[model samples]
Target: MNDKNSTEPTQPQPPKNNVKGAWNQVCGWMQENLFWTVAYVIALLTTVLVGRELFEGDHSATFREWVLFFLATILFFGAVRFVQIFTSCIREDTQKPGQEGESKEHEILKAKELQKIELQKRSWLIFSYSFMLFALFAALLPFVFDVEQRSAAELSKRPIAVFVGCVDYSTDDEAHSREELRCQLVDSAQSPAPGTQAPKPITSLTQQTSETTPKPGEAKTSDTTDTTKTEYAVITNTTKTMPTDTGIKTEVTREITFHRYSKNGMWIINIGGMVNRCNTDIYCVRGGLSVPLYFVILALFGGAISLTRRIPEYQKQAYPKYIQIDEKRPKLQPNQLREYLVFQIVQFISAPFIAVVAYYLVVPESTVVSVTLGFAAGFASETILLMIRAVMDKLNPSTTRSTQFGSISGYIEHNGQPVKDANIRVIGQQGLEAKSDDSGAFVINSVPPGEHVLEIKHTTGTQSKDVRVNSGQATSCHIKL
Candidate 1:
């Protein structure tokens, strides 16, 4: 019985997380992949050098910080993704068994290839872990790595605040271009008055209302008091009795509720959608401060792909037993997010050009059509990448991009509104006529750089306007008819 038990394989225990052991392993891995490690280091240094200008702009400090954050996130996660892909390929290739009837020389070459591939797998895992941390450090240095706004007071330190509510112009008959929205505030600290401090959160407020009347012709009743608390307004109840001239007594009850607010607690605040950083302000609790939370939400979807299962390998398979361990699958950590981001980047590159090409073929007026085209670019990112690669390969290495032709992009308005389907033509320039979309926007490319007269055609009639196109620059045209 003892011998039989000993011979039977014991189930392997799951590996426990060992930080120190993992650190040592990572050091060894980086040493093995020194060339790739150096390349990543160079990329990190370059990003910091380039990102310095983000701080100098007065355009919008909040917007600039968000840009820096985005760049940092992209670089870090991108490195992680690339490393995973490299490791996956190496692991897959090394696992593959060589042909059964191969020559001696082929076998020797295969052995060398397998050895190189094995080293790659180890090095890539290290690169991903290390670079991901480094990238996070670079991006989070501004905010000190704490993005969560735990309390209303912390909101003062955040960059952006998005105001969402109905416009409150307060007695204005006509709406204007800017926003004057009175949004509910989480903490008054965000938008502070010069001398006032944030009001303390109202923990509790209580009020009660009751009527005292002799039950249809019964006797009078005594006064009573009741107390309870909730988070809202505070109301005071008052009753007054006066002697009547007819020798009868009359009783009256009244209740008044007034608005309560604090600089420290939840209060009504005015925020403009596209308005002021302000002379003074009030900020409510919006998770993640002034940051565009929708963008953050959308970003989560990019890295949400699940990791795929490894292909099952049999014990008696042609591949060596050492490649896999104890019939256990060595799970690769990344879910191909890095490779996916590459696809996204390629699609981003192609989208504008794709839209331009499509516009030339058919000038679409519907925004849905444009959005669908963008979606198509993302969905078929691999195809777009392949096409871009093909174009890059075909282009002459010595050729430089010269502004041989200029473009024109602008809007045609009927009074203040966009004139849809209005045609704008470069007089005597064949195939250069472009029709405006719903927003009165139009783009015309490949127009020769020179002074030209544009003819705008609508239901009413044609109007001519003179414009000059600079080399490789878009000429802005806003026609008010």
Candidate 2:
């Protein structure tokens, strides 16, 4: 029987977390959270590509549709994730008030746990509000500033305009009268630069002289014929060239412009559908903030999103829990929370600047799509990262199951002597009560790690001690009264 027992194999334990160097820790973290790492990498790549595309002013409507649809998909995921977390919090809250037949000590512990859960839920609610605000900002960033003011007639024909200039040149010899017409399609802001007529056409005429000798065995010609064609044709899809002693050059220049809409010019030539370019306005819109309206709109969106999540009836009917939670999840540490908050604040502050830079890169040409898409990408990236961190924390088994709870232990003494019947309690944590033994030794179980206030009450008086706790580790403190 001893041999049989010795031969039996024990179950394998989960891997223990070891202290590692910064690089090693990063590697280990990436290895453990490979899914989230891949997701973040993909999001970064997508954001970069989208930003570049926006900056360059990609004109493909299909690409724009694709980006918008991707943002919509991200919103859907964010909403679902928010609903899941919100439902989890609600379930915990609903379960807390229903615990019955428990002793006073156990009830206190339960109540303390519930209070902690409530704090966490409120934090998450604030996080959701932040996300909603970001989304609102992204959605309205293009229209925050008013467009450049223009006359009704200019606005009516603003998409396409023709600046026509006609010049007549007189020459000697045969009294040649050459008529030259210059037509151009310029931006509304770029038109005629205030009180000025169409741009003066820079015209230059060159004369080429050549002499031809007769072929071999033939007589030389005394007179040279000038066979130059002075009449030039201006056609949309045609080219005319003039040959000179220097080289053959095109006489008429044609530029095909791409715009938001096709345009037909009734002038010397038509410069079809050109870019909806901006000039002085920079954004194609006037630069000035309508701060009140913009903030009010964002507030409305945030309030609506908050109310929808907070109302229990709405949560139950609309955002019902689809996934079941079989076990408790790991709670975030204060340090981890600080890191999260810093990261999110950075993202939020940089989001609009990124969009603005992208817009400026494609200035003189409207970058509305780019700014909106870039903003959306930033918002989505932040929201997705938040969701990933929350989900990863929940799925981390070691922190969730083995170290989900902690304990606190210490001694109560006065004048180097044991103080029996000294009651110790964790402030903000009910049911976490302990009485010192004859040796002044006390122990409290089911206490969470991190900062906590410990209050000791005895015949002497009541005193509070601030303490820090670590997961699965015993924290010792001595109180003197």
Candidate 3:
């Protein structure tokens, strides 16, 4: 018997059949994965198209036009999916020979203007997406390069000063002053010494002298000679009081000489609240990129997270042909529309906005934790909304979602003994009744939150009690029989 069993187990089998079956299974799953792959590809293409609108320049949109084809495919997928979901939910959709409906007019009406308008709308519809994936990705690109490239590239690093100690200006600066430097982005040691102040203007005028001609005393002119003073320097010594450090006004007479200088050689810039300098524009670029990185980037990532979380759900609702669950062609469901599908699409589109709202609710004590929380919030957008409703209910106690139903739990007892098999009915509400067990205990749930009447009946007698039910809390009713 052992030799027979061994021979039976060793019987030759066709290896091709086994390989074929395994290949079939692989193909089935590959098709299913392929659907999602296409959806994600469309998502990528949609982002690219949207980016064209955002970052316009002198570049051919050839690659982007191909992306638009992906958009059309995704829309077709959506239309088909919507119809399938709607049709499956329908109970009865039958056609009778005598009950057929038909249009009265033989020819359908069409307008050229309406057709043109629809075409334009169809063209613009190619760019919208479920989330802002590429925008977030693009926004993060600069920080990797522009913000800290030099520091990151250096091999000898971690000297603390290398990261935080660099400033745009220093006293040793050869040319630029402290306030004048713009794009050095590193410390310098070429400036003038500290406290070497520039010369202050001599405000007090002590005396004025002419510069146009020689003075009368020097020229040996007549004793009564008169000199004409033009706006040009005149040869007159005018005495005036001068400001003194000793608090005494001193008067002095002296000759003043005027010198000519080129207009291009002089300049004065008054530093104000804004410093719009630098050819590289480092500060502005850093400021723009960093704000979004710190405060807004996580929200976008969270939106992406929300997209990831819904992949399975989207797959579930999809037509079998679209989801490709197996190798066999699925029986195509009839096209029908449903309200639930519309809401699901709405949730997908609004996820990014919801994530942005959630971003503000975080306290950024730790950046990693904050970013994680933001992504969590986006992934759990519906959960966050429910939490918000719960908080509102707790705070106000009157919101619609806060309206809670009370429950009832009790038992029947008589003279220190439990009553068995007692029936209980709620008067105010329907379809909610309970019966006591051998232990004389019973519980009623989902009783509308308000005042209610409970009627209890047993072999001995019937007892009725008026009870108060509070929203979201359970009530108790103990009966004596």
Candidate 4:
């Protein structure tokens, strides 16, 4: 009994012990690599301040100001690149397999290889993210620092004109040919009147109405020669001719007031369908530091990957005697291809949810119904695909029950926190499968039922576990990696 008890295996200790050490190492690396990050943040803030001054201040650009601007630009780029390189270095060092005591030449060679990989990763990240950041900055800066209004002279230069015509007046007894006139004026052109002074053009027209009648006590008389002369007031049009030779050209001047150095100066830009507005001063001060927030996210991802890499190491340590390797499966069949296609279709359908969220938060005044329609279309397509798959499975029970038909539903995590865009894979007797999305949760359906292996695969490391799935049921699994 004692021998049997001694031979029995004890449960492996949790890697919880390494957490503190790993955190400490990560913090140390961050502190060392973040020198440029700090500088960038400071320079960015300074730029914002200077930009505000430029917008609101009455002072003209001085030689010193130009020099400082040049320096700030340099510092911004420098700090950005430096932090990028430093993070890359740390990522590379963590990925290396050998210990510190390896032969110097071998270590150097490994370092070179690691450096090459880091360079590639950094290049890709910087190229993609920096372009996005710069584009956003370029867009918003103009709106913040510039304010424009139309001048009165410019308004006066707009087309305005007046027209004139004549009409006749009449009473019940006899009609009189009274010349009733109307006048119109236009202000856009030079005054047509015969004077140097320009007159304000009449903007609108009005008419007066009146009636005349004799008293009831007046004796009735016929042809007594009481010819009463009726008078009427009217406006007449006049034309003024210009001398052919005097051709004096008139020019209108418009005034524009621009801020020189105001801290409140703001600019807004909308790019890639994202609308953002910021104070010129604030953007200048913080733009450089903004790049590293993405880096921090990447590093956190890297750390999670690094810690998970130890899983394979620990597997080797714990299961040395039980090691077994399986042969890879053959090429997928038509049905298999369809299954994979359906899964991909579902993933594609879910992608627009992010876009919907982006639109709502970023562009509040946008048509909500249109966005909703797009989302409905995408989601409906996915739902239809799912129904098709379900119907197909129901029609062919054997096919659905086969070892090739399985589903993997799981959440992605980093540092024990859910992380979006983390990829997951499920390896089964039939073949390899994968799925991922922005929400950090994924489901790889149409996989073969029965005992199959699941794995988390990423740039940093891979982890695997065995799970069993019953036909028509999705297998639930949660992997920290």
Candidate 5:
């Protein structure tokens, strides 16, 4: 009977298959959470419309018009929420289990639910991200398009021209006293009298002495006479006096010049002018790649996080032990290690190249290179985390892998509760294992299908046991470590 039992082939267990049902469950959850989707859509549409009007509408619109526009937007959003709630409730009723061809119906319902959920989620997210992007664009718009004005004052001072001729006069006492005696005769002629002729011009003493010339045969005497004459005259003069203390104070104003293109429903405002000023004040309205690039970068990081979650290491799984063991096995050859190291070096060096490209092609001119460098550094940190996880798994088989070279089972404990992240190994064999998750239970799936001698090594000590494995079937044993 024992030989027959051993000879009979055991049935291969069916592969676990519940993924479709799990997807349906997720879809159902999203269908029930429609409020977030509706709110997001309403907010996004309102922002876009209002932002457009603000940019393009006539400047003549009053504050009251703006208030009314905002109020109407609020009412529209509220109405959308009401409709969303009603439709969502109807969807929930249709999703209940047990109807004709129930499984098929469930699948169909699930598909519809998933579609609605995805539409709402994506629409809302796009709206939100786009609104933020537009707001940033608008805020920076004014800086690019406006012109500046400048003013200045100036003053100058200098001396005016006087006369450019010489004056004649005498200060000698003999000349002045002799001229005074002649002046008395002139004064007598100037006295008021009937039939007074103009006074004869006074002649110098030298002229008077020379007036009598020597006649023919008259005795000639050698005599020389020298006399100087002084002239008195009154001169009119004008003088300019400057203030004792004076200073110049200058005031300057500056403005910038630029152009802007604005749009409203059907109206377009193209304002192009120069702002002039004397001082240093700069104003510019710029529209370029930076704002959009920022949003794109943000989306990229979010996508990275989502991608990380998709990896088996991070995803939730029922039998994580088997997966961890498979991942940690010594599969890489020595050459592969060299390749990996080379890859790491290449990745580390490529960051600067990527930043240079982004600065020139993706980032705006106003953005500093330092900001680009910082972004690159943050990306490098994430890459390092991935590398560390891979490297540690390669180096420590006992700590990181799960396999059954020799079978032994144990319960992990910490302060009387089960401890996770604990290491357990079989002595004198390349047999190593670890617990899965926060639960201290583990199973090693790599051992040969047969009874075997096993030793359990823990942090404190080691214990021995005998275990058996059936082909394709797991054998269970329990111990405290």
Candidate 6:
């Protein structure tokens, strides 16, 4: 019986290659990147549409609506991806102590790790360039389409019309009284008649003013005619008409129009007792102004193309496919910082363009459509490319793979309670071992995929159990001591 048990070989789980297996894999992939993929498709369509609209005149409001719909979708996905990135960055800041260890592994595994890092750097570099190219394309779009010319012509035809209406008014009597007082004040301020004396101060409402002393060379005047000017147009009282058997009142209405034009950049017009001043020009519109939008688009394209292809000259120094360095770090020492910069620069270049594109798709005549489209393309292209790259990476399997490793993790308990700080040992594999955490959880990583005996030891007692670990799978086991 012992011989039979020792000689037996554990069969590995078959590769998931059936219809169901393919479906599951596809579903899983979609679950991870479906939103991003959809966004990519929409962005591509918008780009094509915008390009078409620039060269052709057949695009209508419906096309703009479709573009807007896609843009909104992209924005939603971008927001979600941004959140995920932020959370992941936060999580990465806190290091997991259990995962780090000094490995006496062979050179080939180390080489593979280096290759993976290199591949990641290349991927990001390519993504950054793609972003910059898209941005450049957006910035130059208006210029290419001669949108400024169209806007100038449109402005000429429209000539900017403004309208105003009375919102409220004071009681009629109150308004008339205020106007009368204003007129009296204006009359009092008028200059005295030439060669006439300044008027003397009045004492009472019925009293006449005394004569003023004239200058030595000028004649004096009694001015008993009441020199103070009178406002004959002032309404002193409100009159009420006789009411009929049925309650009714008469109303009067009038319409007035004024035409005005700007001279030397100044314009003044009155409408509904409100004065408006406006200065208009083509330069006031951002789209009409001469800006190097094309330069931006070119930069994006150049950056995207240059960074994407791995230059043979830089590979050995910048990122080595295999590192002989004794340090645990993968790739060149400076690669991480460069990688981080690439990511940040790509994001910065793409953000504005993304917004512009989204806006343009919805508003066909929008001034910043180019910038928006550029931003949308730049922002989302990275995520789209990442999905493709990930799929490709999985498809291209390494022929030199060593015996694959899997992991086993479980809880150690005592009378249904967690046994904290328990020791876990795997028979025959010195590399496979772990210690239970405060939650009585233990994980033995990089275990050979096969049947293994797990020994759990605590201060109180010990327990043993058999566990089967499949390649690339996490096997769970529970042990009671």
* lDDT-sorted candidate list, best first: 1, 2, 6, 3, 4, 5
Q: Is candidate 2 or candidate 6 better by lDDT?
A: 2
Over the stretch 283-358, how does candidate 5's per-residue lDDT look in tens digits? 1111111122232243234333322332222212211122324534322222222233223323333433343334
Is 3 or 4 the stronger prediction by TM-score?
Answer: 3
Give the C-alpha lDDT of model 5.
Answer: 0.37
What does candidate 6's lDDT look like per residue over 287-319, in tens digits? 111122432353355334433332322344345
Q: Would you list the C-alpha lDDT of every candidate in the order shown? A: 0.47, 0.46, 0.44, 0.40, 0.37, 0.45
User: Higher-lDDT candidate among 4 and 6?
Assistant: 6
Tens digits of per-residue lDDT, candidate 4, 1-481, equal 3775467677998667688889999788778868754766777887777766654677788655665575567546655663454344222222324555779998788778666654654353344344334333432432344234222223223332111111111244123221111012122234456856654432222222222233333333222111211121122222222222333222222211111111222221111221111111211110100111221222223223322333233323322133334324322222222233333323332333323333222322333533343343233334434544675677874643334465678776655666666546565434455555665688877876677756565544445556888877778777665
- Identify the superior model by TM-score, candidate 1 or candidate 3: 3
Cα-based TM-score, every candidate:
0.26, 0.26, 0.29, 0.23, 0.21, 0.28
Error of 6 at 6 (Å): 39
**Whose TM-score is greatest here?**
3
C-alpha root-mean-square deviation, each candidate: 24.9, 23.6, 24.5, 26.7, 36.0, 26.6
> Which 10 residues in a row give candidate 6 its minimum summed lDDT?
177-186
State the weakest 10-residue window (summed lDDT) of model 1: 306-315
Q: In candidate 3, what residue range of length 10 has the lowest lDDT sum?
A: 260-269
How do the residues 83-140 of candidate 1 rate in per-residue lDDT, one tens digit apiece?
Answer: 5455454232422245578799988887887677546544544444443344334424
Q: Specify the highest-lDDT model's number.
A: 1
Query: Candidate 6, which segments miss by more than 4 Å at Cα?
Result: 1-22, 29-105, 144-317, 321-347, 350-481
Off by over 4 Å in 5: 1-102, 132-136, 139-143, 147-481
* Error in Å for residue 1 of model 4: 86
lDDT of 1 at 197: 68
Alpha-carbon deviation at 413 in model 6, angstroms: 40
